[model samples]
Target chain A: MAVLEVRGLEVRYPRASAPALRGIDLSLDRERLVVVGANGSGKTTLVRTVLGLVRPSAGWVRFDGRDVRTISGETGVSTNLAEVYRLISLPVRDLVEIVARLKGGDPAELEARLREFELGEVLGRRLFELSTGEQKIVGDLFAVSFGPRLVLLDEPFDNVDFSRRRRFVRLIRELRADLLLNTHELELIAQLDGWRLALMFEGRFLGPFAAADLDRLYLTRGTRADALAVMETSLGTFSVTRDSGDRPVKSATSLNALVESLA
Target chain B: MNLWRPYTKAMLANGSLWFWAFAFMAFWLAVGAFVESSGVGPGRSAVVAYTTSWYAVIVLLSLSMLAVAIANSLTYGSSALAYAFRFSRLTPEGYFGSIVGGSAVMGAALSFVLLGATAGMFGGRFRLLLLPADPAGLLAVSLLGGVFFMALAVTMILLVINYLGLKSTNFTGFLPLVLSITLGNAQIYLALPSWFVYGSPFNDLASLLYQGYAGTPATVELGAASVALTWEYLVVGILVWTAVLGASSLVLLRQIRSRQLEEGRQI
Candidate 1:
């Protein structure tokens, strides 16, 4: 059975002409589902609504074969405490232990995961003192370590490094929990293998697309002015660049020729 | 997850907690010394000047004022309460504990600190710890009373922090403290309504201390705290205030819990 299920979900903000979520239907089982969208495309609303932070105007959300509302409030950190929790004066060991215990998960298991990420030396130091990259790693660990049955992450890899993103992807892949990850970056979506990709725009889900289409989406903006082009995705235009007709240069990297030759 | 760990380890770990307690301790100590050397205040006797129930009233009032600042010492209110909610996430009883239990634990611990400091002051200026001037029986009653009042102080802090927050433009939180302190200072000749005078826990405590002793001379003889009111009366009055403050705290806490779930769910 699917661990989380949403059927015909509709969320209407008071006096808003358009619903935040319009008759959305989605489900989650034991797999990673990547949701990509433009800014304010209702990605967060869907996650927040399913997490029970936003009351839906219609339809229902079910988690673990029961109503999501019946389960509990949100499990992961919200944006308000995100910075505070990171900069909070507590040491890493205590924080990991506290979060693990609060989520009803195994602290020892989380410790083991942290060690796998080679975070043992940093555990004794305070979280605020850690570098931004290190903090992102800690955040990712905290989110998935508890092995929650269903996890909703909004922009999980936003501030993380490109080099570290793959490793973080591996870590998420190892999690027992099903994932509903929302992001604006197609790069993050492309890094994952065997993950379902969904599109959203203008407060609606445009539906899922094949992972094979990842490359074309990155063409949203061209490396140069003449290369830019657009293609239709579900409900919105996917911008791309035509690699073949770009001044017929050997590569786009050599703007050097134009600079030295002058206009 | 020991639900109490977060409240104590992180929320109470700040040095400001000690700063307030020690500052007040110094202020009260200075008062004790000044009155002894200068022979001022209502009572000529040093014991009356320092260890009287009137002083207890002052300490309670100070703690109330201090609770305002203490409540803001990072990792409190919505954040702390929300974390505590995790402990009882699936249970109704756990929910109540996280929201209300923080102050209960803190108030109980601080009561002992307050008692020790108040009693320790009887040791003179330099010494304020481990000195027992009051006999065991009377000291116990006084300490119990202190605990109830301290709990009330903590509740006031939580309510103000939850309601006024730091963003409030008005003095909603400070209104009561300002009135109580101002009215209480003028209480000597104010001739306010009887209920109003006694209604203030400060007044009742002062009256208890100001009145002459009825207890065995053994407890009063040590000269830290002297009680005029009967033991039964003191206990009943304190318990009544405890009940009153306890109920008030729960009411305020219900508001905090709802705020956490609804408006304060900032992400």
Candidate 2:
């Protein structure tokens, strides 16, 4: 069963001229899905909407065949490694316990996980007192304790150190939940196998592109045909159809490309 | 998940609670000592005044809430961790119970400290002050009464500000402390209204200290204490206010949840 399904999702901030997200359709099972986009592409909004942190303007989000908004959509291990919960003034242990209770995970399990990350010694320390990297590690550990059925991480590698990034990614990948990880770094998802990748731009799902093009998309951004030609020439192309109106449409290369071909 | 343990742990871990608790105790002790050495605090007839002296303790309880608010701003205030905590099955009731209950418990402990220090300062003369009020009423008013007032007043004050959309951790956290001190100080210089004085727990606590013990209450110069409301009326006020204060905490939880969610943050 699909653990998370979002269709025709639209989100508009109050008094904003443009929507943060337009009509975005997505589905995920237990598999890890990577959502990549430039800043302000609605990656965070999509994750927030799925977690019910932000109410959507239109469309529905279903989790494990249940409505996401109505189902008390707990963010099981949903945390952003890069940001500060600046208001958290308690010790790390208390924070972890809070997350545990929220997402239905065992506090004991969280403690054990913290020890694994060498964060056990610092658990007694206040969150605000910790270094940024230490705080990031603690936040990630709290999420791990949450262990909800669907985990959404926004910018999961933000404040983490270089050495710990890979390990953090590996640990999340090991969790037994459907993961919708929004990250700017494509290399972070390179280690996973059979992972579905998608691009969100101005709140629209632009691709479920093969994971093969994950890193190269940035190098080939332009008009549709130009981008595709560069992608094909540099890597390779698969004849794929995209959803248009009621039926899939096979769009031919653009006029600029056709003229280049005749030349 | 042991429900009480979280509240207990949080209360225990907060130095702010202990700081305010001990600070009030020391300050009260010092004042009592100063008054005795300088020959001032209570007159021979001022025995009742000593028993009712809980202003600092009340402020401490209110300050404790501010401390928690500030602390929470770091975690729940940030929104992401709040999102995790909210859906993770952490009941709003439990969270609130821990924060407010912890502060109340700390206040109760300080009351004991105040009682001990004040009696000692009077060279055992102050000990007999409780002989007039019913023992049960004295104990109830001294211990749980302060706890109830502190919890209700502080929680309501913080929640009202919270409802006003104040999000800055420093602002939300410290404003209560300032308000507690300000409102408390206001009564000192100002001839506060009778009903306002009566409703003001800090002003009326000494009077209400005898919750159920019936007697011809002697009038003391509790200038700010509400004199308009008779003692009988004050008794009903305590119970009603205590219950409402507790109930308001739940409302606070809802307000926080809805308001924070509106901002795409979790409470």
Candidate 3:
């Protein structure tokens, strides 16, 4: 049974010229799903909709067959979205304790887990006092510290140092919860082998292909439609379109190349 | 999470807030005492009336500052940390309750400081001239007034952001504090009708505080004539306003979209 389902989801912000999310359909259970997208591609919007933070203009989102809004308290969904780091006035320790208590987890246990990342010294420091990378690490640590049923991390590697990013990827791989991570870092696809991959462009999703198939995929200029390219993966073939003019496309194997072609 | 302890600790940690809550009122009280000691008034009764009135205004302003601070905590603090509440077992009601509880405790402690200071300062010469007639009543009025102002400020600020489509700026926060202080002291500056004066929660709260401190029914000095405010009128006004504002705040809380708050569209 699907633990999470988002069907025909469309979110249109007030006075927004274009919808933030359009016809997003997803189903996740225990599989690790990685969504790759650029900025303003609606990855955060999709995550917020799933978390019941943003109401959709169309369709519905459900967790365990119940509406997401009604079952949010029971779902144990956690996220590392930047909004979680907005409480700059609070010490990292207070924020962690508050989150742990709210999640019904022991604060001491969560703190002990965060200490594993060498975040112990910064625990007493206010969030605003830390570097951006440190703030992101704190958010990521709390998102996974409680062993939630599902974890949704948006751009978890952004601003993080390469060494910390490597450690974070290792930590994420060890988690038992279903994971839905979205980022523009293409190299992560090879590191997180066996994970499912989806390419998002302007509020739409393109694929759920195997992460391992990324190296085998190819992109070529689209002739039949207004698209960035026609991508061929292990599963099937599809055209990737954007809101703007397309760039010259070549045989693309790396995700970065594909993104550049789309760009 | 233990909301009370954390909220209290967070509030107490703010040194500037402490300065405003204590130092501002202490400064005024010192000036009042100096005036009283200098024998500046016409008679003992006149001096006592002036001192009590001064104390009431100073306390009201102090409470206003505290109330605005609580509202800010509810607005900006919640806006910043809303994601924590959304993903946790803690309900919106629980979070709201904790903030209110923590603020009420702070307000009560401050009231005691004001009361203790007033009694200690005035007890020497005036024989409890400026001390509250009923310390318990004054505390009760402080708690009620503190919560009411917080609710009013929160509702007004949220309405401006959510309905008026205004961004939560420093002006939005300041508007409520200004409006509250003006309305709270309107009777002192303006000679409004008896009904208009007593019907307003701000005036009613002021009257109750005055009554608690002066040991007499609060009299609205309307230029030439005066109207004594009754206990029934003041209590009813406060209760009704608190209930309405509190319910409105809860309704607005339910309608809040975390995305808007995350986007910095709300406080």
Candidate 4:
């Protein structure tokens, strides 16, 4: 089952001249999906909309075949006492504690998680006092603790250092939830394995292109092509007979080479 | 101690402003007390009334202004601070609770300092002086007066912000403190109305500072029960202000949460 499915989604900010997003449809199962676009191309808006942070003007979002609205989206590990720990103004340790309680994580397990992220020493510091990078790591840790069915991150690497960025790439790959990340760095995109790629342009989904197809499309051409060209060039040109629909041209260059060329 | 760290940071950051305000009031009160002590008849009486009243108004007014300044600064600076910290762990409720809770603590600390200075300048009497009408009435007046007046000011501020959405560049977070102080001061000067000295908290608090100059005890009388009741009322009023602000905090927190959710931003 698709972990996340956004269908014909549209979002318009109040008093804005145009919609921030115009009909966007995409889906992901347990696979990681990287959403890439230039600034103001609605990448962050799309992620936020999927997470139920921003309401969609039209269309629906579902997580694991359930509408997002009905999902009882409790973010922390343990939702009850979690609210209290969150209330107290503690530092990194406080965050770990909240994560532990909400997620029902073992204290030892949490401390290990904290150590893994290099935040073990800063556990005693307050949230307001940490540097931007440190804080983002903590935030990422918190999101990971939720064990969410679908995880959406907006600019997760903005404040992350290079070392941490590599760690985060590994973390994203390891996250049990289906992942949807909106980011601009193509380098990060190159690091992922088996993730779908969604290219957005002018508030529309340009491609839910398979990695292979996208590689072929980009290699043969400077950029990803429209649906028809993507199918023709990557799959091969084909002619349709009156009696039969379009057929693949099997004798053409290997489809693998087409993808490899694009890669 | 850790709980107080954020509050203390706020105090230290703006410590100079608070000190300046206290110094200004101290100077004004000292000047009045000196004039009265000099035994100039008309001057003494004039200083006794006007100076004492002004002292009450100025102290609360300065405190209120300072409180507003600090809160407004924090609110406007929060966005940059949020980005700087990368601490997205705090829910909107948590973030706002800390800020508001910190402000309240700051207010309480300042109020206590003012109270101590005023009491010390007098004979260490903490209770506000009521013009004895009936012992019971005097006590009732003090208690209800403190509560009614503070709650009124707090409620008004909340209403203004809720309706206005704190977006007005001019008002934002500062107006509540300003309006609370201004109205509070006005009510203090015009006491003994509304069947129970409407602004008596100011009058009572102010009278403490001026009490050192009050050589004559002025036949003040009130029954013991009324006096006790009045003290209870004042305590309760202060508590009510605390409670109302705390309760209303949840509502504001939720409002902010809803707003952020709409924008796809976490608190």
DockQ of each: 0.14, 0.28, 0.43, 0.10
lDDT of 3 by residue, A1-263 (tens): 79888899999988988888888899999889999877787898898888777779998987778886655355288888656555436787887777776778888876886687777988888877888888788788878876688899988998998888999999899989889999887777788877998877668787787777655544444433754345543334446544333332123343455555444
Best by TM-score: 3
Decide which is better by lDDT, 1 or 3: 3
Question: TM-score of chain A, model 1?
Answer: 0.68
**How well is each residue in A1-263 modelled by candidate 4, as lDDT tens digits?**
77668899999988987788888888877577777666776887786566555678899987667775444324421111111223334466655654454344555665677699777887888766778777666666656664555566766787788988898788778767777777666556667767777655456665664543333433233333233323232233322122222222122143333333433
CA lDDT, candidate 3, residue B110: 77
lDDT by residue (tens digit), candidate 1, B144-210: 4444544465466556545654343124446435654665455543444444544556555444433
Ranking of models by DockQ: 3, 2, 1, 4
Name the better of 2 and 3 by TM-score. Answer: 3
Give the candidate number with the greatest DockQ: 3
- What's model 1's lDDT at A208? 58
Show where candidate 3 strays beyond 4 Å.
A13-17, A70-72, A85-88, A223-263, B28-40, B74-85, B116-129, B166-169, B189-192, B221-227, B259-267
Error of 4 at A204 (Å): 2.0
- The numbered model that scores best in lDDT is 3
Best of the two (2, 3) by DockQ: 3
Candidate order by TM-score, decreasing, is 3, 2, 1, 4
Q: How accurate is candidate 2 locally (lDDT)?
A: 0.55
Q: What does the lDDT read for residue A64 in candidate 2?
A: 67
Reference-based TM-score of each model: 0.68, 0.72, 0.86, 0.60
Which docking category, incorrect, acceptable, medium or high, applies to candidate 2?
A: acceptable
lDDT of 4 at B13: 58
* Pairs that clash in candidate 3: B75-B267
